[model samples]
Target: MTETTVTPTHASRTGGRHDEIRFGTSGSTGEARHWFRLPHQMEREVELIGTRLVGPVDRVLNYAPPQHLFGALFGQWLPRIAGVPVHQAWADPFAPLPVSPGERVLAVCIPMAWDLLRRSLPVLERAGSVVALHSSAAAPPTAHELVRRAAPLLRAHEILGSTETGGLAHRPLLPEGPEGGDAGPWQALPDVSFVRDAGAPTRGPEELVIRGPRLARPEHGTRPPDRWATGDLVEFTGPRAFRLVGRSSSLIKVNGVKVHLARVDEQLKACLPQTECVVLPLPDDSLAGEGYVVFWSGRGHAVGIADVRAALRDFPSPSQIVELAGIPRTPTGKPDRSALFAEFAPTSA
Candidate 1:
């Protein structure tokens, strides 16, 4: 894991002297990009989130590191705004939560933390009320069961955003059935709005152009753009709500057929509930111009390469199937795609 260093610099703006906070991207896509934000801008985010997502709370248990944007917002700022004491003892993935019997606890977590917390159900059940905040990735099926078992006592919410865009949208994590959870369409934040990219096709999923107050300035210290064109594709469901179609970069043409790696990953996850899988695109010399490989880990389960092939038979199968002891992940808990490519991608013979 590489360390991200944040250097706060002072800048003289129109109204007052404001300090800029630097944040490093997760580097899941490729090289990390640095972005800057003003303290007041970040405060506005804290205010919006504190008013919308966070309600009255007795204490906050922060599982995310404060260096990450999500962590800083919920873990550092939200607690201060709520005037509540926060405990970081639960930072360790395997540590037990500090929830008391009657406290209304706000648990700020990343996607990976949910699985660890689910294992300590006996402790979580003791809380009077639990508002679990999830971000950085989609919550797994285990999170749904965690909420179900703690029913009437726990409620979970997922936030959608990135390092460049502070916080764009949010949705309640609701149980669909006995099987898994549904993070329905994301609703834009009060300060955020979206438009379809001009270059996008008229008929289908379009790229989202985000207009918001929380947009970060480029690392070179220029004014933030009025509207930031994002690489994510979405289908608008309402005036301010949309269902994510997938990332533009994740949609690739394989053998002249379009394939969405995120969608394929979702399918594989549903089929192999006990296994962790990642599907990554690879270059091909064939007319297709692109190919993909599936990497999976059984997590002590009996799943095998043959099982993965059978699951993906109906879809465009991968050119290779590689099993590993575990999938590589960024410090922020996203699949380390760049690292995976460097390690597993074939070299020129």
Candidate 2:
């Protein structure tokens, strides 16, 4: 899907709510799709996420894609709910910042867009500028430091939740300590609870099951959520705190070793500059099982298959690494692993 445009109206200029907003999702395992949210729903969401997190803010500089969850909730709706000016753009990160510094401003961002914006931090920070940067979709561990250095006053936030449950929790990205830093105590949204596995002693490496108002009913004939099983694997730090590992389906078993694809890709991408890579499971016809494969996007890089092998010395040997024009990406800029793997499926003998 491509970017969308919003028009100016009396409601927009006078700080009234945006009557309609588009919500899009690249399904858990396939291409992207979009839906339209009416004014009442948009207002409810704006106040819901805004008052909960930032609290009665006056202005927001929206940069997150309107189609994404966090973007639609925080970036687009938050300002309207707060009755403040909203500066938004439907363009690439290369575009200039819509609002000036030294003003109380907030922006919702994803990992990729955060990385792109951090590239221009020298121009982003100001005396009274308070940047509430919320990152979701994927953690921007790679861009945390750049964000801190560029905007000293920036308070980077990582939003934890799905479209179904709204924003479940938030953690800040601090300057010192862990690279993918976290801030604030994890607090559950009102009326939301963790649905634990029946057999587990507590929430430990269990799926993120949720029960809440935002949990949508099954649509398009989709399967109903048996208590909204998130399929995301998480590890608990406390009764209320948990760190996300990855999606349950994203975990691959190789020779009895469970490998997190995100971890493997992070290690490989660290070694290869400018190359964005994605790892996926491909079923082996001969082996009667599945193995890993990586697809990367970039040019003008000398890194080859052998370099990748050496970089992945500690990692398991994937079935293959097939370089392509680009790693197939969903409309939301996330990798389309299932589609990519099918492209390389072995032919029947």
Candidate 3:
């Protein structure tokens, strides 16, 4: 997606009088789709996030472009609600934030910005307080550690939702234990609830059917549905809390065995916390059907193909483990799977 210049008029405005606010879905899976939300729907979302997720803030250092849902809500709406100034220069993930000493900052960031923020620890420590908001992907373990070791006032939060659902659930990015990062479940936001998908099997991971006030309407301007069936499969850990199992679309069959691409990627990420990698399914005649491939970048680290293979010993070995200088990503910082497949699938085959 193209980045739009942030202006004072654009940054301070809210969707108060618009007939419907249109947002483009992050084109991580394919072509971007358009969704619409009523002005009241957006106001309620901002209210919930502002009251529950965000408190008073001196200013906002927004690292996400306003086009993305998370960016629009937190980067734009939240600061406007709080009547705080915003710094959009930090929108570039790699750029150093302009946080000043004694200013309580609401650092709106996407998942990809965490690593770059980690590199700016000294600069971050100068702030009176920092609340880092992350979305568009899972927050890396490093982000949790960054919060754990930073000034006691530093906090990191992760939001789980889509452009269509706005902000459905959130959880703090706590420090990882010796075993691994905190695998805690996400708590549904106020006025939001979910259940197992009706068509799902009685056992195993089930797709979620979410019901909430934040649901966006179709771009055609119809009334929003009472419930939204999401593609994400999850396991209920408690009332109003659940851990993501994976996405139904991401679950692929390989040699008659079920493999979740998200789960595989998570395990690989666990092993190489600093290295960037993704697992994708590919056609394989020898395997009798689809097989998986690992696309990884050392990112200046000494990680190797051997290291990646060693980490996947328990799972089905990837047909190919290719390393690149860097992983391609969408404007929202999600891995551009279509681009990756187009560039590498032919060579892998």
Encode model 1's per-residue lDDT on 168-253: one tens digit a residue.
88888776521343357889999898766567665577788889888888766577778877788788878898888778777887
Query: What tens-digit string does per-residue lDDT give for candidate 3 at 223-326?
Result: 57788877888888777888888887778876677788878887787788778898877755763567778889999998888888888876776667878888
Q: What is the lDDT of residue 162 in candidate 3?
A: 81
Model 3 scores a C-alpha lDDT of 0.73
Count residue pairs with overlapping backbones in model 3.
0
The estimated TM-scores of all candidates read 0.89, 0.75, 0.86
Clashes of 1: 0
Could you tally the backbone clashes for each prediction?
0, 1, 0
Ranking by TM-score: 1, 3, 2
What residue pairs clash in candidate 3, if any at all? Answer: none
Worst 10 residues of 2 by lDDT: 1-10
Assess the local accuracy of residue 212 in candidate 3 as a C-alpha lDDT between 0 and 100.
Answer: 85
* TM-score, model 1 to reference: 0.89
lDDT of 3 at 84: 84
lDDT of 2 by residue, 1-349 (tens): 1222223221222233445343444555434443333455446655655666555454676666665666666666676566678766435557766555566667666556666666656555642555565644454444566655755566666566655445666666555423233333455666567877677856456777877655532323232244667677777777666776667876887777878876687677567646667777665446646578777655657766787777678877887777777666554455665668766645321
lDDT of each: 0.75, 0.59, 0.73
